[model samples]
Target: MALFSFYNVRKPRQYNHTPIYWDPRKEALEERIRKNKRELGMEEPLEDYKPQIKGTFVEGTSHLKRSYNRGEDTRARKYKTFKFLLWLVVLGVIFWILFFK
Candidate 1:
Protein backbone atom coordinates (compact mmCIF):
# COMPACT_ATOMS: atom_id res chain seq x y z
CA MET A 1 0.00 0.00 0.00
CA ALA A 2 1.51 3.36 -1.17
CA LEU A 3 0.70 6.62 0.67
CA PHE A 4 0.81 10.24 -0.68
CA SER A 5 1.40 9.05 -4.27
CA PHE A 6 -0.47 10.07 -7.47
CA TYR A 7 -1.64 7.85 -10.38
CA ASN A 8 1.00 6.36 -12.76
CA VAL A 9 2.19 9.09 -15.25
CA ARG A 10 4.95 8.41 -17.81
CA LYS A 11 6.56 10.46 -20.59
CA PRO A 12 5.54 9.48 -24.11
CA ARG A 13 8.25 7.88 -26.31
CA GLN A 14 9.53 10.05 -29.23
CA TYR A 15 9.68 8.61 -32.72
CA ASN A 16 12.72 8.87 -35.14
CA HIS A 17 10.81 8.96 -38.49
CA THR A 18 9.59 12.23 -40.08
CA PRO A 19 5.84 12.55 -40.76
CA ILE A 20 4.75 12.49 -44.48
CA TYR A 21 1.93 14.92 -45.35
CA TRP A 22 -0.45 14.02 -48.19
CA ASP A 23 -3.67 15.63 -49.63
CA PRO A 24 -5.93 13.15 -51.49
CA ARG A 25 -8.26 15.78 -53.04
CA LYS A 26 -5.36 17.78 -54.55
CA GLU A 27 -3.79 14.57 -55.95
CA ALA A 28 -7.12 13.49 -57.51
CA LEU A 29 -7.67 16.94 -59.10
CA GLU A 30 -4.13 16.95 -60.58
CA GLU A 31 -4.65 13.37 -61.89
CA ARG A 32 -7.98 14.36 -63.49
CA ILE A 33 -6.35 17.42 -65.17
CA ARG A 34 -3.50 15.23 -66.50
CA LYS A 35 -6.04 12.70 -67.86
CA ASN A 36 -8.00 15.50 -69.56
CA LYS A 37 -4.84 16.88 -71.16
CA ARG A 38 -3.95 13.38 -72.48
CA GLU A 39 -7.43 12.98 -73.98
CA LEU A 40 -7.23 16.45 -75.62
CA GLY A 41 -3.75 15.61 -77.07
CA MET A 42 -2.35 18.77 -75.35
CA GLU A 43 1.17 18.82 -73.92
CA GLU A 44 1.56 18.85 -70.12
CA PRO A 45 2.06 22.48 -68.98
CA LEU A 46 4.90 23.16 -66.52
CA GLU A 47 3.70 26.71 -65.60
CA ASP A 48 0.69 27.67 -63.44
CA TYR A 49 -2.69 28.03 -65.16
CA LYS A 50 -4.72 31.19 -64.41
CA PRO A 51 -8.45 30.84 -65.14
CA GLN A 52 -10.50 33.74 -66.50
CA ILE A 53 -12.43 35.68 -63.85
CA LYS A 54 -16.16 36.00 -64.54
CA GLY A 55 -17.72 38.75 -62.42
CA THR A 56 -21.33 38.18 -61.32
CA PHE A 57 -23.49 40.81 -59.59
CA VAL A 58 -25.11 39.11 -56.60
CA GLU A 59 -27.05 40.91 -53.85
CA GLY A 60 -25.59 39.88 -50.48
CA THR A 61 -26.60 40.64 -46.87
CA SER A 62 -23.73 43.16 -46.51
CA HIS A 63 -24.96 45.24 -49.49
CA LEU A 64 -26.97 48.36 -48.56
CA LYS A 65 -30.29 49.41 -50.21
CA ARG A 66 -30.09 52.37 -52.64
CA SER A 67 -32.35 55.44 -52.40
CA TYR A 68 -33.04 57.57 -55.54
CA ASN A 69 -34.02 60.86 -53.83
CA ARG A 70 -31.25 62.65 -51.91
CA GLY A 71 -33.06 65.58 -50.22
CA GLU A 72 -36.43 64.14 -49.12
CA ASP A 73 -36.37 61.73 -46.17
CA THR A 74 -39.97 60.95 -45.14
CA ARG A 75 -39.26 59.78 -41.57
CA ALA A 76 -37.06 62.82 -40.73
CA ARG A 77 -39.59 65.23 -42.26
CA LYS A 78 -42.45 63.73 -40.19
CA TYR A 79 -40.34 63.86 -37.01
CA LYS A 80 -39.51 67.55 -37.51
CA THR A 81 -43.21 68.43 -38.15
CA PHE A 82 -44.32 66.54 -35.02
CA LYS A 83 -41.58 68.23 -32.94
CA PHE A 84 -42.57 71.74 -34.13
CA LEU A 85 -46.30 71.15 -33.39
CA LEU A 86 -45.44 69.88 -29.89
CA TRP A 87 -43.32 73.03 -29.14
CA LEU A 88 -46.08 75.34 -30.48
CA VAL A 89 -48.71 73.77 -28.19
CA VAL A 90 -46.36 73.98 -25.17
CA LEU A 91 -45.61 77.70 -25.81
CA GLY A 92 -49.29 78.57 -26.27
CA VAL A 93 -50.17 77.03 -22.87
CA ILE A 94 -47.37 79.04 -21.14
CA PHE A 95 -48.52 82.28 -22.83
CA TRP A 96 -52.20 81.73 -21.82
CA ILE A 97 -51.27 81.14 -18.13
CA LEU A 98 -48.96 84.26 -17.86
CA PHE A 99 -51.13 86.87 -19.69
CA PHE A 100 -54.78 85.63 -19.43
CA LYS A 101 -54.57 84.81 -15.71
Candidate 2:
Protein backbone atom coordinates (compact mmCIF):
# COMPACT_ATOMS: atom_id res chain seq x y z
CA MET A 1 0.00 0.00 0.00
CA ALA A 2 3.03 2.34 -0.13
CA LEU A 3 3.85 2.27 -3.86
CA PHE A 4 4.41 6.11 -4.10
CA SER A 5 2.75 8.62 -1.83
CA PHE A 6 4.81 11.66 -0.86
CA TYR A 7 1.55 13.03 -2.17
CA ASN A 8 2.59 16.73 -2.47
CA VAL A 9 6.01 16.43 -0.87
CA ARG A 10 7.80 19.43 0.60
CA LYS A 11 11.29 19.44 2.11
CA PRO A 12 14.10 21.59 0.60
CA ARG A 13 15.44 24.86 2.09
CA GLN A 14 19.08 26.02 2.13
CA TYR A 15 19.51 29.29 0.21
CA ASN A 16 22.78 30.70 1.55
CA HIS A 17 22.23 33.86 -0.62
CA THR A 18 24.92 36.14 -2.12
CA PRO A 19 24.49 37.56 -5.68
CA ILE A 20 23.62 41.18 -6.65
CA TYR A 21 26.12 43.21 -8.60
CA TRP A 22 25.62 45.42 -11.76
CA ASP A 23 28.43 47.26 -13.54
CA PRO A 24 28.63 46.31 -17.23
CA ARG A 25 28.34 48.56 -20.31
CA LYS A 26 30.79 46.00 -21.43
CA GLU A 27 33.11 47.64 -18.91
CA ALA A 28 32.90 50.83 -20.93
CA LEU A 29 33.55 48.95 -24.10
CA GLU A 30 36.45 47.18 -22.57
CA GLU A 31 37.92 50.47 -21.47
CA ARG A 32 37.58 51.83 -24.95
CA ILE A 33 39.21 48.79 -26.44
CA ARG A 34 42.01 48.88 -23.96
CA LYS A 35 42.62 52.53 -24.74
CA ASN A 36 42.63 51.82 -28.42
CA LYS A 37 45.00 48.90 -28.13
CA ARG A 38 47.40 50.91 -26.03
CA GLU A 39 47.36 53.95 -28.31
CA LEU A 40 46.95 52.26 -31.71
CA GLY A 41 49.68 49.71 -32.02
CA MET A 42 47.25 48.00 -34.44
CA GLU A 43 43.93 46.20 -33.81
CA GLU A 44 41.44 47.87 -36.18
CA PRO A 45 40.61 45.67 -39.18
CA LEU A 46 36.86 44.81 -38.99
CA GLU A 47 34.86 46.79 -41.59
CA ASP A 48 33.32 44.93 -44.51
CA TYR A 49 29.83 44.92 -42.98
CA LYS A 50 28.78 43.05 -46.17
CA PRO A 51 25.28 43.83 -47.78
CA GLN A 52 25.44 44.78 -51.53
CA ILE A 53 24.25 42.50 -54.34
CA LYS A 54 21.10 44.23 -55.73
CA GLY A 55 19.42 43.81 -59.18
CA THR A 56 20.76 43.08 -62.71
CA PHE A 57 22.70 39.83 -62.89
CA VAL A 58 22.65 40.03 -66.72
CA GLU A 59 20.72 36.94 -67.89
CA GLY A 60 18.62 38.34 -70.78
CA THR A 61 19.41 41.93 -69.90
CA SER A 62 15.97 43.55 -69.90
CA HIS A 63 15.29 47.23 -69.31
CA LEU A 64 12.02 46.65 -71.14
CA LYS A 65 11.54 46.71 -74.97
CA ARG A 66 9.24 44.88 -77.40
CA SER A 67 9.87 47.91 -79.66
CA TYR A 68 6.90 48.79 -81.83
CA ASN A 69 6.58 52.42 -80.80
CA ARG A 70 4.46 54.72 -82.98
CA GLY A 71 2.39 54.68 -79.88
CA GLU A 72 2.65 50.95 -80.02
CA ASP A 73 1.65 51.10 -83.67
CA THR A 74 -1.37 53.10 -82.74
CA ARG A 75 -2.44 50.71 -80.12
CA ALA A 76 -1.82 47.86 -82.43
CA ARG A 77 -4.05 49.44 -85.04
CA LYS A 78 -6.84 49.76 -82.57
CA TYR A 79 -6.52 46.17 -81.59
CA LYS A 80 -6.76 45.13 -85.19
CA THR A 81 -9.88 47.17 -85.63
CA PHE A 82 -11.38 45.55 -82.62
CA LYS A 83 -10.49 42.15 -83.92
CA PHE A 84 -12.10 42.86 -87.24
CA LEU A 85 -15.32 43.82 -85.59
CA LEU A 86 -15.32 40.60 -83.71
CA TRP A 87 -15.01 38.59 -86.85
CA LEU A 88 -17.82 40.55 -88.40
CA VAL A 89 -20.20 39.67 -85.67
CA VAL A 90 -19.27 36.04 -85.75
CA LEU A 91 -19.70 35.88 -89.52
CA GLY A 92 -23.04 37.60 -89.30
CA VAL A 93 -24.25 35.01 -86.90
CA ILE A 94 -23.17 32.19 -89.14
CA PHE A 95 -24.75 33.89 -92.08
CA TRP A 96 -28.04 34.24 -90.31
CA ILE A 97 -28.08 30.64 -89.25
CA LEU A 98 -27.30 29.38 -92.73
CA PHE A 99 -29.56 31.58 -94.82
CA PHE A 100 -32.41 32.57 -92.54
CA LYS A 101 -33.45 29.58 -90.49
Candidate 3:
Protein backbone atom coordinates (compact mmCIF):
# COMPACT_ATOMS: atom_id res chain seq x y z
CA MET A 1 0.00 0.00 0.00
CA ALA A 2 1.07 3.59 -0.80
CA LEU A 3 1.51 5.82 2.30
CA PHE A 4 1.43 9.22 0.46
CA SER A 5 1.02 10.90 -2.97
CA PHE A 6 4.04 13.16 -3.60
CA TYR A 7 2.80 15.00 -6.73
CA ASN A 8 -0.38 16.48 -8.27
CA VAL A 9 -0.75 17.45 -11.98
CA ARG A 10 -4.18 19.21 -11.79
CA LYS A 11 -4.51 23.01 -11.66
CA PRO A 12 -7.29 24.98 -9.83
CA ARG A 13 -10.01 26.68 -11.90
CA GLN A 14 -10.22 30.58 -12.00
CA TYR A 15 -13.52 32.41 -11.12
CA ASN A 16 -14.31 36.01 -12.22
CA HIS A 17 -18.15 36.01 -11.81
CA THR A 18 -18.60 38.49 -8.93
CA PRO A 19 -22.03 40.22 -8.79
CA ILE A 20 -22.65 43.99 -8.32
CA TYR A 21 -25.38 45.32 -5.96
CA TRP A 22 -27.51 48.50 -6.19
CA ASP A 23 -28.57 50.53 -3.09
CA PRO A 24 -31.80 52.60 -3.33
CA ARG A 25 -31.11 54.66 -0.17
CA LYS A 26 -27.61 55.63 -1.32
CA GLU A 27 -28.96 56.67 -4.73
CA ALA A 28 -31.67 58.83 -3.12
CA LEU A 29 -29.08 60.45 -0.80
CA GLU A 30 -26.82 61.27 -3.75
CA GLU A 31 -29.75 62.79 -5.67
CA ARG A 32 -30.67 64.92 -2.64
CA ILE A 33 -27.07 66.19 -2.28
CA ARG A 34 -26.92 67.09 -6.00
CA LYS A 35 -30.24 68.94 -5.70
CA ASN A 36 -28.92 70.82 -2.66
CA LYS A 37 -25.74 71.79 -4.48
CA ARG A 38 -27.75 73.03 -7.49
CA GLU A 39 -29.94 75.15 -5.18
CA LEU A 40 -27.04 76.56 -3.22
CA GLY A 41 -27.71 79.81 -1.21
CA MET A 42 -31.41 79.65 -2.20
CA GLU A 43 -32.56 77.98 1.05
CA GLU A 44 -31.43 78.00 4.66
CA PRO A 45 -31.03 74.82 6.72
CA LEU A 46 -33.93 74.19 9.13
CA GLU A 47 -33.36 75.47 12.65
CA ASP A 48 -35.43 72.68 14.26
CA TYR A 49 -33.67 69.88 12.39
CA LYS A 50 -31.33 67.76 14.54
CA PRO A 51 -29.30 64.65 13.59
CA GLN A 52 -30.60 61.96 15.93
CA ILE A 53 -28.12 59.87 17.93
CA LYS A 54 -29.28 56.45 19.12
CA GLY A 55 -28.92 54.70 22.53
CA THR A 56 -28.14 55.86 26.09
CA PHE A 57 -24.81 57.65 25.56
CA VAL A 58 -25.99 61.28 25.21
CA GLU A 59 -25.66 64.65 27.03
CA GLY A 60 -28.07 66.93 28.97
CA THR A 61 -31.32 66.60 30.98
CA SER A 62 -32.68 63.62 33.04
CA HIS A 63 -32.08 61.25 30.11
CA LEU A 64 -28.38 60.68 30.83
CA LYS A 65 -29.03 60.32 34.59
CA ARG A 66 -31.88 57.90 33.89
CA SER A 67 -29.56 55.85 31.62
CA TYR A 68 -26.92 55.67 34.38
CA ASN A 69 -29.55 54.60 36.93
CA ARG A 70 -30.77 51.91 34.49
CA GLY A 71 -27.18 50.66 34.05
CA GLU A 72 -26.69 50.45 37.83
CA ASP A 73 -30.05 48.65 38.18
CA THR A 74 -29.06 46.05 35.57
CA ARG A 75 -25.63 45.52 37.20
CA ALA A 76 -27.24 45.02 40.63
CA ARG A 77 -29.80 42.62 39.13
CA LYS A 78 -27.06 40.58 37.38
CA TYR A 79 -25.01 40.37 40.63
CA LYS A 80 -28.10 39.24 42.55
CA THR A 81 -28.87 36.60 39.88
CA PHE A 82 -25.24 35.28 39.97
CA LYS A 83 -25.32 35.09 43.79
CA PHE A 84 -28.69 33.23 43.72
CA LEU A 85 -27.39 30.71 41.14
CA LEU A 86 -24.18 30.13 43.17
CA TRP A 87 -26.24 29.42 46.31
CA LEU A 88 -28.51 27.06 44.34
CA VAL A 89 -25.47 25.08 43.11
CA VAL A 90 -23.98 24.93 46.63
CA LEU A 91 -27.30 23.74 48.04
CA GLY A 92 -27.55 21.03 45.36
CA VAL A 93 -24.03 19.75 46.20
CA ILE A 94 -24.75 19.78 49.96
CA PHE A 95 -28.00 17.84 49.47
CA TRP A 96 -26.30 15.31 47.18
CA ILE A 97 -23.54 14.68 49.77
CA LEU A 98 -25.98 14.41 52.69
CA PHE A 99 -28.57 12.04 51.11
CA PHE A 100 -26.91 10.23 48.16
CA LYS A 101 -23.44 9.60 49.64
lDDT of each: 0.65, 0.64, 0.71
Candidate 2: tens digits of C-alpha lDDT, residues 1-101: 67667776767998887758756897889988977885675654334223232322322344222323223455676797899999999999999999999
- Of candidate 2, the 10-residue stretch with the lowest lDDT total is 50-59
Q: Number of clashing residue pairs in every model? A: 0, 0, 0
Worst-scoring 10-residue span by lDDT in model 3: 47-56
True-structure RMSD for candidate 1: 17.4
| Clash pairs (backbone) in predicted model 3 | none
The residue-level lDDT of candidate 1 at 24 comes to: 88
Q: Which regions of candidate 2 deviate over 4 angstroms?
A: 1-72, 79-81, 88-92
Candidate 2 has a TM-score of 0.21
Higher-scoring candidate on lDDT, 1 or 3:
3
Using all chains and alpha carbons, the TM-scores for the candidates as numbered come to 0.30, 0.21, 0.35
Candidate 1 at residue 5, lDDT? 52
Per-residue alpha-carbon lDDT of candidate 1 for residues 4-90, written as tens digits (9 for 90 to 100):
456775669998886598888999999998988976869545443333222122122222112113343557667878999999999
